[model samples]
Target chain A: MTDNKYAFFIGCLIPYRELAYEISARRIAKKLGIKLITMPDANCCGLPIDPVNHEMSIALAARNLCIAEDMGLNIITLCNGCFATLTKTNKQLKKDRELRQRVNKYLADISLEFKGSIEVKHFIEILAEDVGIEKLSELVTKPFNDLKVAEHYGCHFLRPHKYLETENPENPTVLTKLIELTGATVVDYLDESECCGGTVLGIDPNIPLSLARDKLKNIKEAGAEAIITICPNCHMIYDLNQPRIEKTFSETYGLPVLHYPQLLGLAMGITPEELALDELRVKADKVLSRLVEEIKVKH
Target chain B: MSNEVKTYRKPLRIDPEFKNLVLKMPGGETLKICFQCGTCTSSCPIAQIIDTYRPNQLMRLAQFGLKDKVLSSKTIWLCAACATCVDRCPQGVEMASVLRVLKNLAVKEGCVPRVFKDFGSAILKTGFVYNIPKTRTKKREDAGLPPLSKTKIEDIKKLAEKTGFIDTIKGEESDDRQ
Candidate 1:
């Protein structure tokens, strides 16, 4: 029985750009009794080039699916982009025979075949569904004590509802409910479903900077101490670009952006070192220090 | 007062087959069904922030068979692919997917944005957009995680050639070096 085992597919970003996200996710999954088996030879999830070449995008995603099928385990993706492409291609291939035949023919060159048996899920899905919020709350050693944080629902996690039915597109409650389990309050902000604008960062970076600045403006106005993100790309845009956004917009909003995994790890009583929280571009010191003070009084 | 109807005209070249051409492309079949309601534009996150990116106008251009104008505009490249507009469309018009089709068409027509071409070349060469630096590998090792794996370059190259990606990026590689 493939009960809790998952073929972990960490796309390009987390391994290089966002190590803290990967570290915390692994540490938390271990504590939750879930097994994540890394597929070493997995390539990019093909989202970065989806617009340029649809065929290449689908083929790359199919190759990863085939790799997971060989292990006889479902996929658990860390990045939202990976989840979108994998789920989209998996659904497309299962429903469209011609597409399946074409992708399989391409895979034949690499000695792989996509059978479409394996399922692809975001790490949040596994947490919300498999772990169950109540059990997650029970495992929390240090609650956020009403730390107000905003949730940035990265685009691919909830949209294209025909394929991704995990949450409502307009107003998602899964990420909010999961955050509540950490004892943190999800602050409401404008355009919560707003794109992080990372997609156009390369074409015209100033646009994303302004967009991120706008989102941060709303986040700060809502009195959020930090922002929580599901996708590394969003995290990079928000966390890594906070200073740049400040420089560009001539404002100061030092809102710490944490990956949901990092926040969950903190509540699970995992130390900062284990989660690699120190490596975050925007420091979570204010939030972490508050927790430290609360823990001191509790003891 | 002169009671005359002054008809002003500017030359417009419309390709009646352009709409059909777009319909034949993957994700472009629904190009004709868009009612030009501006819902896609209003719902688009990028469109709201960036004044130049108008999804509704782009759709109109596509439907009008303004091939050159529709494909060359920076607006098509500005869509973040958030799917908000697609989900919000009352007519079930997959605006994001249609935009993808337009972007691919733009590339074949040799009007792709410089950034996209650079990203494509990087993918063609390494199978990953960005190379994982040695410092990053050390950090991953410190965190008790396995180092990032190297992709099978030969297989990726084979797939690219079959998908015409190799040809798309043929001359662009040398141009990037300078």
Candidate 2:
């Protein structure tokens, strides 16, 4: 129940596709003194199958909430999809008695119930709200003042403002502010609030590729050294699929996409190997080399 | 002998009760308030790239009780559910949720996409959507991470069955005649 402790809800995509996010998040959490208990029994946040059955999605999210409630701790998710689904379902189930009864009926079969006791949050929220920028700045032993990076605040993180209510969906500042905490300049780019189109990549690959291409094009044009992201799905679209987008569009955008934790971990003086920076698809050598050269000159 | 002209097209059938049914769904309450301002379409990231998928047009179709057209269109599956439209809509229509309702109805009509079926089957067998490979699970330990918590599959299956998710995924409720 302590503010620093959380039940880490490692959603499906992180384990299957984006281990770098999980690795760096863990490394940074350790350095920050935050305790992350793993929710091994957590199921998918129910977003992937939401189109087939809405009520089922609610039920699945409620089951995970029940687990967190049982542990008597709040939940922290690495993926925006999970954050959105669990937070929204938690809020809805708490407010709507009828909906709660319906979802609880499904939970009853599994011997679980949605008590609506705990809250769900994304990692960014934890750092911004609980850890605070002031304290985070003090931990930055090696600031990236020389680096400039653009941020992708994947849609689910802030949209459906009624459900999330975290920030302005149209012009969110949380990710940009968090990026600045690393002492890196947050470059302004066109369509900064656009969705990375990761959700529909399963349905039609071409459309998401086009959407990601536009984002990369804008960021490259804006003169950002790299693109920073928080969501694993967004990371997959921009980082893992960057080369594919380059090929499909006949464009060269060798932009390195860093998970926010990797960026923050570097500033916190965590080694690249520990943060798993090499695991990234697009090489971050340009950014890392600049940091090394800066340190060498300083010494 | 060549004077005979032939035309083949089924007359459009509008179901008056379709709108009510949609309204009864969780996210479909605001269906009647949409004035067709085209804001949702313009706000949509997917619609910008794909001219064929327009949220406003879908809203109009649903409003007109074009149940078959609204449910059967491939464009309904194209929504990323980013909810940009939901935030921007002056009517407060919750376009993403409305689209989800349409998608659910489409699946009920046996129009489930191949990928969703794979995701559903994966969740049924494993708790996660994409099955975490054994090598990756082993790699977690090497990376100084704890082993992933094992899911109680029996509990998950019981919940899935209670929610009728099993029937939906199995397509048992689908009318084969369609």
Candidate 3:
């Protein structure tokens, strides 16, 4: 009855590498009075080979979307790649009669159909629009005002650019604003919109890593206390591979990265243990613990 | 057409942006062999759509260390991730994927030219990732769309889990923030 029940589209990354993010999302949603439903049968948003296989990607995203339509529910997704790919495909299929006809022809064999009932959304927009930042502010029990953070937006999530209208894609601040609402200072960095070289990692890793090195260097140089990410793939390279990248370069750029969910959860007073901030590949170690102590001491 | 030919300087140099972008590919080390044999030029759909690129020139910049030129070239943005060029390359370079990597670089560099954000957000709300149906798409036939395979949230979640898709999804929320 409009009472905040959201279907949590965990996608792929958090359950495995960034499980902390999932924990954070759930905990934060609970605090905000919005229920995140982790439904069964939620398969891939079918974003595999999205850059290459349009039809295949659409079909896969469609399959996911179709299920939600069947449920008569609105979906709130966590990954920008899945969010962008699924929504873009649906919009294209819906608006372009010809493309839709072709996609539908492919779908008929699989028994899947595109019903626009499913509204693909980034958690930020929903949080901003549906949940509202004002409400978010109300939920903030402890803001980490001492922390300095940089926001990184992955390519699939926002670059092709006209789809996710929550902010100006070029200089987006949705995450920064959300973080700011938590009383933290948004750190500035020249390479904030930099790529994580995600697509290249699966195929030829060197090219991707080399690309990632550029941004990692910038975030480190920016003196950011932490780097916040919105996509799982981006987190993997930046959060998990930063060590490997530094090793390859014969240097060290030890920076802690957090998913938006985790950051929000932390600020909302969710305990570090409950949010599982300790589970990341890069390890929160001194980062969160120290931040927590600082807060506790200040209080 | 004949009169305009006179205004064309012997040959307008290749887009400066493409030149540099070619050098920026993470390990885009082999980008130099492409001499615009007119083969890629003849095959590109983007070139057909927009007259701003020549695959040959773009290939040339890859070899010359023109990183910014290549990255900023409209050519990189125009690419639709089609594998035709990769298939056509005599050097066996995975051009499509390479360009995609470059495009990803471009996006990171602030090249979200248009329509990418809205489309992404739309899919997040509904599982479809797009405007498959406006409200409650109960009947596929109603929208002249194909009936979809009935999938459960768990099925998609598993697929996402198998692919480590959660990181990708959550990252989007974090990355796109202001």
Best by DockQ: 2
Q: What is the lDDT of residue A188 in candidate 1?
A: 94
* Every candidate's TM-score, chain A alone: 0.96, 0.96, 0.90
TM-score of chain A of 3: 0.90
What range of 10 consecutive residues in model 2 chain A has the weakest lDDT sum? Answer: A290-299
- Residue pairs with clashing backbones, model 1: none
User: What would the per-residue lDDT of candidate 1 be over residues A167-218, giving only the tens digit for each residue?
Assistant: 7888789899999877788889987788888888877788788889889999
Tell me, per candidate, how large a share of the native contacts it keeps.
Answer: 0.69, 0.89, 0.04
Please name the candidate that would achieve the greatest lDDT relative to the true structure: 2
Expressed as tens digits, the lDDT of each residue in A1-299 for candidate 2 is 78689999998999898999999999989988999999869898999999998878988899999999999999999999999999999999999999999988888878898998999989999999889888887777777757889989899999899999989887888888888877789889999998888888878899889999999999999999899999999999999999999999999999999999999888877899999998899999877764532431221
DockQ of each: 0.55, 0.62, 0.05
Per-model TM-score, in order, reads 0.94, 0.95, 0.63
**Candidate 3 runs further than 4 Å off:** A1-3, A289-299, B1-178
Error of 1 at B171 (Å): 5.3
Real interface contacts reproduced by model 3, as a fraction: 0.04
Tell me the spans in candidate 1 whose CA falls farther than 4 Å from its real position.
Answer: A292-299, B1-10, B171-178
How much lDDT does each candidate structure score?
0.83, 0.87, 0.60
lDDT of 3 by residue, B9-82 (tens): 55434444554554454324446555545666565544553455566665555455455555555555445433
Cα misplacement distance, residue A191 of candidate 2 (Å): 0.9
Q: What is the TM-score of chain B in candidate 2?
A: 0.90
Model 2 segments more than 4 A misplaced: A292-299, B1-9, B172-178
Backbone clashes under 3 angstroms, per model: 0, 1, 122
